[model samples]
Target: MTLVLDPLSPALLACLDHAYIDGQWLPVTGSERLPVIDPSRETVVAGLTGATGADLDRAVAAARRAFPAFAATSVAQRIAWLERIEALMQERAEALARMLTLEMGAAISHARAAHVPFAIAHVRAAIDVLAAYPFETLRGTTATVREPIGVCGLITPWNWPLYQITAKVAPALAAGCTIVLKPSELSPLNAIMFAQILHDAGLPAGVFNLVNGTGPEIGGAMASHPDIDMISITGSNRAGVLVAQAAAPTVKRVTQELGGKSPNVLLPDADFETVVASGVMTAFRNVGQSCSAPTRMIVPRDRLAQVEALAIAAVAQIRMGDPLDEGTVLGPIANQAQFNRVQEMIEAGIADGARLICGGLGRLEGLSQGFYARPTVFSGVTADMRIAQEEIFGPVLSIMAYDDVDEAVALANDTVYGLGGHVQSRDLEQARAVARRIRTGQVHINHPAWDAHAPFGGYKRSGNGREYGLPGFEDYLETKAIVGFA
Candidate 1:
């Protein structure tokens, strides 16, 4: 399982010292350099610096300046722009995939199969939604027109850097809103490449600007800036709160895709072998880094033994190793801090009396280096346990036994987070009934295919506003009622 770090490519290296601003690579205006660490080897592959105050000011101002014309752009023009961006992204998909693997320890296979492809999917979805959207509607004696919200401040997370960027940017562009993006300082190489893609795709100056910095620096600035009309952020609830607070002074709109401890409830009639195994894999996918990952598995108490056996078998199939290797299924945790957090949560689960079924504490066998984590599973997890309730952004699964359907639903909806949930049932009506009760943005029945256009956001503390599809595109728009204009 020992693997050497992939050497930094020259193109990625060249992207380190500068950023894309006003549609060009500009020198960093700040002195502090943030090292981009490869989580697999815990090595600094490259460095990034935050946009200085003046630099952030310039970028925001540029977006503000370009908003008028961009907002006025015809729908056909916006669609064309999206098509071009999608084409460019498709061309560089493999390179971006590699950058993701190197910069954030995503498995090479995952980066190719899930990460890059889904990112491209978002752009394509935006195009399709925009083409058919009704920008103007007549109601009674008034004409309701949807216009661009104006300059946008986008802050994306490291977990799905490119996907999140495209999720925000593509929709913003399709809605005709110009944006300044602050990608995660941790995994920034892909952002660097993405800015280049925008440039190659001929995105107008200031229509899409890139700035790399910490939340307090670039994120705070963008959220607080009066010229930036809306700020969409995807990260932890803590980060989302900070952004919302900062933006409040300006009365700017803030959209967020934050954390989740989503539930996977297996109904009594569900087949334990198939459902448990699939649930284990789903929960552990992306090393459990996904915001909507089903980390909590709720099952019928009578079938706990059967579920545990199947879950153990599922966990055994996972191959944890170097991200670049084709055989590797689970890679290392993306960063040191997250690595430590996962470890802490695993230990807390043990201390909290949750029975550890397999995998616990420390690196994978003989894998002395890197952030490689043990694919862990815990049974007998109670509702109050930290392992069951908190968002452990690692490959850990907590299995809780429920006495009945009501208890199962209650357990699923118990958390403060309502980002995502899953229900398994043989009867479609039963599944639908259970799905309606869970207080989350989206629910999946029988492990359905991912819908790129479904509206995705959370309820409660998981954050606000939706992303994906027409709703995502429209989130960047403002409504205008032209009175008596029908």
Candidate 2:
């Protein structure tokens, strides 16, 4: 029987589905293991059997063997398999949601609607895009055929869990590529559950593999492996750089969706109360662990006081507690290190002379055991301040005032990260213009629906690569031009 984790806690629960290697689930040899922490309760959920060099070798070997058959699958069949994954994930949404909550401290509601749906939606969208995708195009006497690259190494982060995995895996599978998945140890439970859905859907063994471990051992191995045709990673800028470096020698394609210090620009004419409030709440949503979270809010200088007032009032409403608690809008940081990191950044913000508007440092009252952080907001923050420049990965908002739209755009583009940005505007044209000016991979205009058919990635240090939609499918394929073929 396929192992699937259900009774979630951070103890040695023997991974429900250990790393899948050589078409079978297996454990590491020695000196390799990862402790999955329940971020909300600051306790061990499970000890994941980490991937070893031998495990990586086995997975890579399996993928190589499965590649010829899997890649030769007809486009129609690939699309059908992707569709199967979508339906199966939808059928098992509740279980996936529950596993995600226990694994990563994501709110149950968010996990259900955002996490689970995101994964399913991306897979289905890939199927849809594949239907319309120009697999073989003719130009004059020449024909161009886009074929699968080969066996792939996929590394996903913990924040969004399955959402990121599907974004990579779905499109690659749709393009007829085999893959090995390296999910974050912090959120391994969800990956296992997702894999079970795939297995149940009858995905051929070796077509997909899952190896859980730290970045140094398994991640590095996957990146540098010669048998692996390409590698995709979604993580921090530091991690992205490391992956790229490892893959450089092998000359393998390395695509990354990394960190972001995204900006939220509240127009001068925009309703200050509603915009700032919503922006802050969204920023702190998921305890501000999102890579696309607009941690910095750029407002007009004259409206600084008004914006600050609304932001403080808004963030105050988010209830922080257990991830399973329906009342809790914000849970603890993913772990102790993250909590400490946020605390240190909050202190740095204070030291830099930024005024604390509300919710300062330390754990929430009555819940001192978990990794809870008092949702923090810093006002009177300058552009050069650490809080405004760095990706804190917490529910801390930095308020920065700008003289005009030009200044706001500049401030928004100042950071090395260009993953995502949010803009509130009354005029569509103006928002579009501002969106173009921002150098981010994605710009959300007026809380637009996250269409899974759109390309999502970063422009700069946020990392290079796009996932989702047609562009995402293209990443998994290589085009070959045949002369006089048409």
Candidate 3:
């Protein structure tokens, strides 16, 4: 199918075939072109050429050139740039949402509601952070100051596409750092549009750059490059380790937001009727692509049957279909590899003796063309089962039963990942106590509202550092102390 680019200007559409380097749309030469497939249709919608090593060199050099002046700009000037970018994003929200739905197979409603809007929130949040951030403070006889951490190399994952880009880019810019962004090649179109938005907002040339390519070519180079002062990545644990290893030679700061097998501890006192269904939907949100998705549902053994019933009913409510369709609550896995992985894990669950309560291996009935999978749930899941231990990254839930609150907390903290956790109970004190015991970076008491200001990162193999709000903005800065200043 020929992907339509309506409403967007001809120049922005042309970004698919090139890289934005040194503030210019330069042809991506001497590299293989990869096809961008629409997961819902299993068809190639567009093709993007990977950036060559030479392209990476030029992009990095450009960011290095722009860093000094950009970093020296007044905080007010940086805030204005972010505000302009946010305004442009708002004006083109519909088009951006359409790109997300088409390229990544996000449901139109989800694209409009979460993907696009939340991305804009990052820019706004950065603006808010930059407006009042104290760059310098006096402590006793010493004057300590925070300064931009030079040029940044940002690598974002395909699952959250636009959201991850803004999460990194906005804060870097707000901190007065120039950037070279390497967005996932699987969803390059939206990143191109974002480059156009930044361009139209009149951001200085080279302050922001884009290069589309595989992680090895662009991301590896960025991680190792001496000119890039810092590197941040939101991707798989394997990828994060590789980046960290490559960056070790340079001694550059490397921050990563990696994998997770987060747990949802549903305490016995909680409202099972209310929390169970919400837990099911939250685990399956974004088709379970979120790194922090609570796929492991921990419940009291006595209440397992009730939780299973609610989970099965919740799965029944999911409408898996064309992502463009308004009624599609669940879409296909983002790519074929993820689809295959999900199927293999589900098979492992069956072989390992976890009881299949609803849905199962293979595509959902009536949807054989796309990369779709059944919204599956497995009961009687032990903590050691592959379905419970692994990150499925699909619309699959593992309901593990626990005998007591201590065991429940143990199950919640069982994973090698410590990215996110969830606790549900009617007794606020009990829930708070349980939340403290879970060894994760962030814990939710009762599905609290998404807070842009909250620090987000992992604790163990889940990776290091945080993103969003003040912590996120501060990550792009360096500290200096003038000890003699009084």
lDDT of 3 by residue, 365-475 (tens): 988799988999999999889888889999999999999999999899888999999999999999999999999999998999888788899999999999999999999
In order of listing, the candidates' clash counts read 0, 8, 0
For model 2, which pairs clash?
3-16, 9-45, 10-44, 10-45, 10-46, 11-44, 11-45, 11-46
Off by over 4 Å in 2: 2-5, 8-17
Off by over 4 Å in 3: 1-10
| Ranked candidates, highest lDDT first | 3, 1, 2
Per-residue lDDT over 1-486 for candidate 2, one digit per residue giving the tens place of the 0 to 100 score: 533535453222444335766556676664555777888777786776776878788888888999999988887888778878888888778888887787778888888778889888989888888888887889898999999999999999988888999999999899889999999878888787777667767778899988878889989999999999999999998899999999999999999999999999988777675778889977887789999999999999999988888887887687878889887777678777788999999999999999998888888888868888898899888888999899999999999999989999999999988999999888888888899999999999877777998788998898887988998889999889999995
Model 3, position 157, has a per-residue lDDT of: 96
Clashes of 2: 8
Whole-model lDDT values for every prediction: 0.89, 0.85, 0.91
Clashing pairs in 3: none
> How many pairs of residues in model 1 come into backbone collision?
0
The residue-level lDDT of candidate 2 at 208 comes to: 91
Q: Give per-model TM-scores.
A: 0.97, 0.97, 0.98
Better of 1 and 3 by lDDT: 3
